[model samples]
Target: MKTISIFTQKGGVTKTTSTINISGVLAELGYKVLVIDFDTQCHLSLGYDVDKETEYNVEEFLNSVEPIRYAERGKHQNVSVISGKLKLSTKSLKRDSLKKPLKKIEKDFDFCLIDCPPKPINDDLGFGEIAIFASDYIISPVDYDAFTLDGLTTLIITLDELQQREKLTAQYLGFFFAKVEENTKDFKEAYRELSESEISSLLFKSYVRKNAFIRTSINTGESAVFLKPFSPVSMDYRKLTDELLMKIKIDAK
Candidate 1:
């Protein structure tokens, strides 16, 4: 199975939204997709309509003595989700034990999409390195803002250091511009600035447009792909998923 981690050093860049939308679209296309919500906020889990009272959360699965299985099957389309609890990030589980739950679930799904949390304040590099180590590809959702770009630079540096130290093999699958508005002067300048930088090569051609439908869908516990399949935002996500699949195939070669 191929595992992709949706991550960003900065939050509020549509990381969980992208994860849910992409997973839903992939499942609609007949792929057996499993989404694991690793963020402490549990936003992605809520998007899948998984109730908070559910007993089988990621924390319980990781710390369980026996083989853990997901309680809810599929909510949005054909995609199954492993919900995250607020306590998942507070457990004393080791990295090896944390990895075991995912490894066990990987056998049942064709694609695994991990929604990682924002980089930790104490040690940004540690979380990025561990997420990269577990993923086959990393997709960074970026907002066209100065501070967000600066955060992206820090993330790139962390990934570079990890690759040099551990000889990591995961592909950096490029950035997706979230909440983009090309008409605005600030956004236009920000996009141009990022395009001219060394990291420009890592930017994806498809960008998600700023849309009210996105917020509405999230508020109602639905993905944009499922809420408005014919909307521009939905089409953008579909294109992004296609490009991601192509990149994965090329990387495998």
Candidate 2:
């Protein structure tokens, strides 16, 4: 199975939203996808409308020594979710702890997508490194801003450092712009700068446009793609997923 983490150090960049829609599109195409809520906010879990009262969550799974259990299913038959908890960041988890547990069920799904929290590499939360260590690839969702752009650089540097020190095997797949408002000057300037930047080659051609469907999806507990399949933003996600599959060299079944 291919494991990927949707990550970025900055918040409000639609990391969780991207994870949901990408996985949703994959499920729509008949791929068995597993989504892990690695963030403390539990936004991804809630987005899938997983049972909140379930006895097992991502934290429990990580901390438990027992056998692996079945994951909670979403509306889509092809999708399974490992829910997140609000207190996950408060606990101290060992680095690479998620790797072994995930290995137990690697054969069950075609792809595993992790919804990581917005925490810097050096932060005490430790969720960032844990998710990265467990992933085979990392795709960051970036916003149009100086801080967000700088955060991308920081992530690259951090990944390089981890590669040298911890022997991290996860490849930095590339980045895609999310929540884009193309009519804005900020968007134009940022897009131009990104195109001319040293890391321009790492940018994805598809970008998600800002829309109300995306904003309403979390409350509806469904991916925007499934909620409004023909919407422009949803169509953007489908194209983005296509590019993602190409980047990973995986054919949609």
Candidate 3:
């Protein structure tokens, strides 16, 4: 099975949205996908409308005395999720601790997508870093306005350092622009700059433009593709999924 982490140092960049949307699209295409809500906000958990009273959450799974449990089926048939809890970030988890637990359940799903938490105030490394260590590829969904030099530098440099020190095998897949407005000059300029930057080679051709339908779908606990399959943004997601599958050399069953 393949594993991926959707993370960025900055927030409000559609990080969780991208993770769930991609997982949903992949599931729609007949792939078994597992999405881990690695954030304390529990947004992904709410996306699938998982029961808040469940005895098990990410916090329990990570810090259990016994074996780590597998993610359970969500509202989507082909998708399973380990729901994040309110105090998830407060738990002190070991570096690479997830590697074994994920491996145990890897055979059950075709792909695992982790929705990483936002960077904490003082810590240099957190669940986001750990998620990458357990992934095969890293997708950074960036909101151009918030992708500041400090955030970019810290994220990039930390990845490089972690890859070396942790002996991790994951590689960066690319950056994808999310919540963009094609009509705005500022948005266009930002996209152009990102594509022309030194790391231009690591940019996905398909970008998710601002779509009202996206919020509508999210609010209703369904994917835009499933709710409004013919919408432009839904089509963009399909194209992005196609691009991602081709890049990974995985054929849809």
For every candidate, C-alpha RMSD to the true structure in Å: 2.4, 2.5, 3.1
Model 2 agreement with the true structure over 1-253: per-residue lDDT tens digits: 8999998888978999999999889998889998888888888887877764464688777876575454545456788888887876646677778998889888989999999998888856478788889999999999988888888898888898888988999988889999899899998888888899888878988899998878787788888777888999889999999999998885223
* Candidates in descending lDDT order: 2, 3, 1
CA lDDT, every prediction?
0.76, 0.85, 0.76
Give me the runs in candidate 1 sitting further than 4 Å from their true place: 64-67, 71-77, 120-129
Query: Worst lDDT window (10 residues) for model 3?
Result: 65-74
TM-score of 3: 0.88
The number of the candidate with the highest TM-score is: 2
Query: Residue by residue across 1-253, what tens digits does model 1's lDDT show?
Result: 7889888778789989999888878877888887777776888878767875564676676565465555444344467777887755433544345456667667788898888888742342333345556678889899977788888887777677756876766778888898888699987887777788888888887888888888788777777787788998899899999988988898889
Order by TM-score, highest first: 2, 1, 3
TM-scores for the candidates: 0.89, 0.92, 0.88
Better of 2 and 3 by lDDT: 2
At residue 192, give the lDDT of candidate 1: 77
User: How many pairs of residues collide in each model?
Assistant: 0, 0, 0
Q: Which residue pairs show backbone clashes in model 1? A: none
Clashing pairs in 3: none
Candidate 1 displacement at residue 134 in angstroms:
1.5
Tens digits of per-residue lDDT for model 3 on 136-252?
988887766744534765777767776787687788777787787878987788778877888786678888989888888888777677777789888888888887877677422
The weakest ten consecutive residues by lDDT in model 1 span 120-129
